[model samples]
Structures are given as structure tokens and as C-alpha cells.
Target: MNPEIYSLFDEPHADNEYTYRHNIGVGIIATYLGMKLGLSKENLSALTLAAMLHDVGKTRISDNIVEKPGKLNEAEYEDMKRHAIYGYELLKNIPGIPPSIALTALQHHEREDGQGYPQGKSGKDINLHAKIVAIADVFHAMSSSSGYAVL
Candidate 1:
């Protein structure tokens, strides 16, 4: 794992072990997808970094908000939507970070049909790396009990 990614996991605010593990799972899935797509080493690295830190901005949210046992109100949902931009802000200044990684923070919420958050970007408007990360993120979140548990 990249040192930067490891440092993200070590953050005090990232105490939700479920989210951290989910992020790592997404990164691993994205990495494999990138390799299968025949992405260059540099591209693979960038995608991996993007997947790893995709949820880093969640650190700014309170544990109560992230760990709510029930559904969130509209206001709370709006706050949750800001995490992607917050993630971009957190990763943008890191030295040696690829633009693709930062872009993932902005574009990962986008959907193929344009039914997503932050930006309602659709189809090719989103980068390939971001798309891959988004798919992996949703996959992990849906499959993990602590992520999107359907009660």
C-alpha cells in the first residue's frame, strides 16, 4: 500500500474500521480492473490511489453522521454529498499525486445515467479511473454490512 494511503487509514477521524477496510477493498478491486483493462503502470497507480482515498473526506464528518443507525434527513444527506469535494480539497495539495487521483475525488459520484451527486456528470464526462473507482466503491458499499446495510 502507498504510504499516503496508509497515513489516511491512520487518521484519528478515520476510526470507522469498516469504512477504511471498504476503501481498501475498493482500491484492490479497482487495481485488478485496471490491470484487466491493460492500463499502463502509471494509470494503474493513479487509479489505485484514487480508490484508496475516495472517501478520505468522510474524516471531516462527525461519527454520529457517518455511523447513524437510521436514515439521514435531507440536510444530513446534503452534508454527506459534500464529502467528494472535501476529498478533492484534501488530496489536491499532496505532492506527486496524479491529477487522475484528484479527479476521482470529484468524479467518482457521477453515474452513467447522470443520477449522482456533486456533479450529475454522465457517460464519458467522467474519467475512466473515476468510473472504475466508483464501480468498486458501490460494489463494496453494497456488499458490506457496515456500509449500506439494508434493514
Candidate 2:
């Protein structure tokens, strides 16, 4: 892993661990699915990297909101939703990072039904890589034994 990428996981904040594990698990699952789907090596690598960093924006959000034990009020939830765009902004200026990769961070929260936040993109408006990362992210969050059951 690149030093910069590795640094993202160096500090394991109690609240952020769920986000970290969720992103990593998405990468792993996407890689496996990419192989099964016969994706090219370059494509697979891009998807994996995108998946791993999809929630990097959450690093900028408040732990009080992210790790809250109870349901979030509407305003709080909206604030929490901004992480996707925030993550994209953080990755956008990084030298050599592809636009597609940055977009995954921004678009993973998007739903097929156009109900997602940060951008209400629907169907083909969402990039294919983002779609793949979204599927992997959902799968990991649902299948894991962690307390993300309420998500």
C-alpha cells in the first residue's frame, strides 16, 4: 500500500473503526467479485482502491454524530450525509488520483432509486465503479457480526 493510503488506518479511533472496517471489507469483496466477473487487472485495482477509500470523508465528521448510540435527528443525519462529498473533496486534490476514484467516495451513498444524498444521481448517472463499491459496502455491513445492524 502507498504510505499515504496506509496512514489512513494508522490511528484506530473507536468511533471510526466501523467506517474503516466497512471500507476495507468493501475493497476485499469487490476484488473477489471483480475476479469472478472477469474484470481487467487495472479495473480491479481501481475498484479496490476506490472501495477502500470510499468513506475517507468520514474522518472529517464529528465522532459524536458518527458514533451516536441512538437514532440521529434529521439535521444530524443530513450533516452525517455530507461525508461523501467531503471525502471526494479530500481525494480530489491528491496528485495522480483518478477522477473515477474520487467519484466513488462521493457517489457510494447513492441508491439505484435516486434516493441517495450528496447527489441524487440515479441509474447510469452513477458510475459503474461506484455501483460496485456500493454493493460490496452493503454486503460487508450486512454480513459482518459488528453492531452495524441498526444501519
Candidate 3:
């Protein structure tokens, strides 16, 4: 594997180790979930890459919003949510990137109940890989933030 590919993750703020860790953790978990869901090996590989880069758009966000220690105000939160669209644009522009990868970046925040942001896509409207990455992302975020072993 090319180390250059991984170096992209390091492009984000070095002080935000949690974001880096979250990306890697979600990648592993999402790939595992994909495998368990009977994805082909090619699909699993794409899932791993997609999950790791799912939050790449956060780089486009301001440090004030992304690194804030307190809850965001309504306007700030709206701006923060643009990271999804940013991520999609970033990945989709890269030559040879898979459609699933860009879609996952854009749609991972989507919910089955259609309450998610960037787009109100619900249920089947969301890509399967995006759905799996969403679950893995939440699990990892909760476990890492709470220091608990999720069952």
C-alpha cells in the first residue's frame, strides 16, 4: 500500500488526535460490518477506505466550530453540518475514487427516520455502505468518548 494515501489523514489538524482516531476506528469497524453483511472482498476494501475518509470534509470547517469545547449555537451547528457535503465533494473530485466512497461521506449522517442533515434521505435512499459506516461511526464515537466497551 502507498503511504501517501494514509498521509491524507494527517493533513487535518495534528492537535485533533480524536478525529484521526475516530476515522481509523470507524474504518476498521465498518469494514468488519461490511464483511459480516456479506459484501464482496472488493466491496469491503472500498468500505474501509470510505469509512476512514468519511469525515475528511471536517478539514474544510473552521477550528472555532470543529474544535469548540462547548455546544454549538444553531447557526454554528448548521455550518458544521456542511462537512458532509464538503467530504462528498472532496472525494468525488479525486480521480478513480469509487462512487460508494463519496456517497458514504455525504450520507453517513442520514438516518432511517429521515431526520439526518445535508440531505433528508431515509432508509433505502441511503447507500448500504453509508448505513454500515454510520453504525460503526456511532459505536466508535460512543465507546471512545465514554471509555466503555460496547456490547
lDDT of each: 0.79, 0.78, 0.82
Q: Tell me which residue pairs clash in candidate 1.
A: none
Highest TM-score scorer:
3
The candidate that achieves the highest lDDT relative to the unseen native structure: 3
What's the residue-level lDDT of 67 in candidate 1? Answer: 81
List where candidate 1 sits over 4 angstroms from the true fold. Answer: 1-6, 147-151
- Give lDDT tens digits, candidate 2, residues 110-138: 88999887789999999878888888888
* Tens-place lDDT digits, model 1, residues 54-81: 8777777777777887798888888877
Model 1 TM-score, 2 decimals: 0.88
Using lDDT as the yardstick, the better of models 2 and 3 is 3
lDDT of 3: 0.82
TM-score of every prediction relative to native: 0.88, 0.87, 0.90
As a whole number from 0 to 100, the lDDT of residue 117 in candidate 3 is: 74
